[model samples]
Target chain A: MKGRAEVRVMLKDTVSDPQGETLQRSLVSKGYDVSRVRAGKFLQLELTGYSREDIVARLEEICSDILSNPVIEDYEYDLEEVLE
Target chain B: MKGRAEVRVMLKDTVSDPQGETLQRSLVSKGYDVSRVRAGKFLQLELTGYSREDIVARLEEICSDILSNPVIEDYEYDLEEVLE
Candidate 1:
C-alpha cells in the first residue's frame, strides 16, 4: 500500500528564531503591526511498501528522530492512504 | 481586536530542495522506503490593529514579498479573528 504524511516541525519556545526576528523587522518596516512571528518547517512525504501501522510508526519515528532536533524542536503529523 | 495568520511557503517544482534530499537520504538509511519528499516553511503570526480585510491583504503581501522568494517559492495563508 502507499501512504502520505504531512509533518510540521516547530522550534521549542526556548529556542530563539533569528528568521522570525528578521521577518518581524521586515514587516515593521512595511507598516504591518506584527507583535511577533515564529517560523518552522513543514514536510510532505510520499511512502511506499508499508502498512498503515508501519507508515504511522515509521513516520512518527522519522519525524521525531530525523526531521526535527529533539532538544530544540517538536513535531506533529497527519497521515493518509494514497494511490500508487 | 487581534488576528492570527498561518503561512506556508514551498519551493516550486522547478527548484531543487536540498533539505528534502538530505532527509530522503537519512530515511533511506533508516530503511523507510520514501520515494520522495519536499520541505517548506511554516509561519504563525500575531497581529493587532487590523480589520479582517486588512489582515488578509497585508499577509498576502508579506507572504509574497518578505516571507518567500517569488522567483523560486510560492506561499499560501489562512487568517482568523482572535481574542486579545
Candidate 2:
C-alpha cells in the first residue's frame, strides 16, 4: 500500500537560525508586526513499496544523517494515508 | 493559557528545491541510499497569551504572509501541550 507522508526538520530554539534571523530582519523591513521569526523546512513524500516502519527508519536516518543537525535541529513527522 | 506549537513548511514538489537538492547531493556524497530527498523547514513556537484559534490564525497568517508560499507550498502543524 502506498501513502503520503510528511517530515519536519527544524533548528533547536537554542541554536541561532541565521536564515530565520535574516528572514525576520527582512520581514521587519517589509513592514510587519512579526517580532519573532524562526525558519524551518517541511518534507512530504509519496512513499511506495515500503511499510510505515521502513519509511520511518529511512526518514530518521535522513534526519540524523543530513536532513537535520541532531546536535541542534530537532525533527518530527506525521504519516497520512493517501489514495493510490 | 499558552502552549507549544510546531509549523512545517516545504517546497511544492512541483517546484525545484535547490537547497534540498544540494543537501541531497551532499548526503549522497557521504554515502547514503537517499534515492529521493525532499527538503523542508519546521518551526516551533511557544505561543503565549493566545488560544488555539488565535495561534492558528497567526500561524496561517505567517505561512501565507511569509512562511510558506500560498502559491505553491502547502503547510500543516500539530500543537503539543506542555507544562508551563
Most accurate candidate by DockQ: 1
RMSD of 1: 1.6
The CA lDDT at B3 in model 1 is 84
Model 1 residue A35 lDDT score: 82
TM-score of 1: 0.91
Instruction: Please give the DockQ score of every candidate, comma-separated.
Output: 0.80, 0.34
Off by over 4 Å in 1: none
lDDT by residue (A1-84, candidate 1, tens digit) is 788887888888889999888888878888989988999998889887647888887888788778889999988888889975
Minimal lDDT window, size 10, model 2 chain B: B31-40
**Angstrom error at residue B18, model 1:** 2.4
Alpha-carbon runs more than 4 Å astray in model 2: A1-5, A18-38, A45-57, A77-84, B21-35, B80-83
Sort candidate 1 into its docking category: medium
RMSD values, in order shown: 1.6, 4.3
